[model samples]
Target chain A: MDMRRLVGGNFARLRQAKGLTQEDVEARSGFSQQYISGLERGQRNPTIITLYELAQALGVSHVELITPQNDET
Target chain B: MDMRRLVGGNFARLRQAKGLTQEDVEARSGFSQQYISGLERGQRNPTIITLYELAQALGVSHVELITPQNDET
Candidate 1:
């Protein structure tokens, strides 16, 4: 429900779906792998710019990464 | 392209669409009006919980607030 958790969950899901590793995202995003790990665990409170970078690296829009989907709807 | 800017722009847009004010959001989300102002100005880096609360108050998914819209798509 929280943005951090939502972002983390979505990030993991999308990354896995894309068959990407943390290293891959890090390389693409110019962020540290450790940062990616923390982000996935919802341990980091990212800035807007960071979110944009992550979204771009993941090939998803920032909205898709932050919004929670209603599976039923 | 920053998350702060994205969230602020989306928040302002949605709030205006709903005819809600920062005070209304503050009353609904239990946050301060000043904080809302800061948030809407991209001056705040909110926590996940804060984002969730804001989303609920605004009757939107967190994703909608954070993601950038592709006007073409």
Candidate 2:
């Protein structure tokens, strides 16, 4: 699987599901909004630590950030 | 959330559940057995790409490598 795209799709979906903007995720994860935006576009290669931080920001398990949801990426 | 330890525990569990050794994963994932050992011991930090490769070697999704299962870790 394409980890970058998969994580991008899942991150976008999860963040949206939580009614959070990239800026909100940035505030919560200590990651910049630009980084979040890039990740959503599958343009960033995030490590597991980044995934964990983002997942926590979205109020979800880290697993959710990497799982391929139905018809999403 | 210590991502390194979490991935380590999950990876070890998944690998063992598949009845495969570190050497087996090494051969399949092209990651060294020594590296796999360190990772399983929570001593290594793996990128998302590494997680994906290890997951593929274990015949599972990348998410499986990061998921926290019951009574593990």
Candidate 3:
């Protein structure tokens, strides 16, 4: 599987689980909406700090953003 | 707290815990020795794919590389 897609899909699922929109994530993460959108679409390869900020914004562990779910495991 | 330092420190610690040197990590992850050294020194902001590969090389979950230890938590 594409690692970027795995990360992007996981990130999107976590954000949606918390009922957050991309705009909300952008606001909380201080990343641009375009950046977050690109991330969710698997068009970006985020740095560790970016992942950290996004996890903080989603109120989840940073691991959650990168780890595949049980189905994928 | 510097997120880069936190990640770098955690990565180094995890690699050490596994008794794997930088060379070992480079060999296992297929990342360059310079890249691994830079990452361990907190001088590199690695992409998610890099982190994923490193975590695999360390035989641990990717989250372990980025998460702060209990002392910092």
Best-performing candidate as measured by TM-score: 2
lDDT at position B73, candidate 2 = 38
TM-score of chain B of each: 0.86, 0.87, 0.85
Looking at model 1, the pairs that clash are A48-B3, A48-B4, A62-B67, A63-B67, A66-B63, A67-B63
Stretches > 4 Å off in candidate 3 = none
lDDT for residue A30 in candidate 2, whole number 0-100? 82
lDDT of 2 by residue, A4-70 (tens): 8888888898889889989988877788999888898988778888777777788888877887778
For model 3, state the Cα shift of residue B24 in Å. Answer: 2.9
Off by over 4 Å in 1: A69-73, B69-73
- Write one digit per residue (lDDT tens) for candidate 2, span B4-63: 888888888888998999999888778899999999899987778878887888898777
Judge candidate 2 at residue B26 and give its lDDT.
Answer: 85
* DockQ top scorer: 2
Q: Which residue pairs in model 3 clash with each other?
A: none
Under CAPRI classification, how is model 3 graded? medium
Q: On a 0 to 100 scale, what is the lDDT of residue A42 in model 1?
A: 82
Q: Fnat of each prediction?
A: 0.68, 0.81, 0.87
TM-score of each: 0.76, 0.88, 0.81
Q: What is the Å distance of residue A7 in model 1 from its true position?
A: 1.9
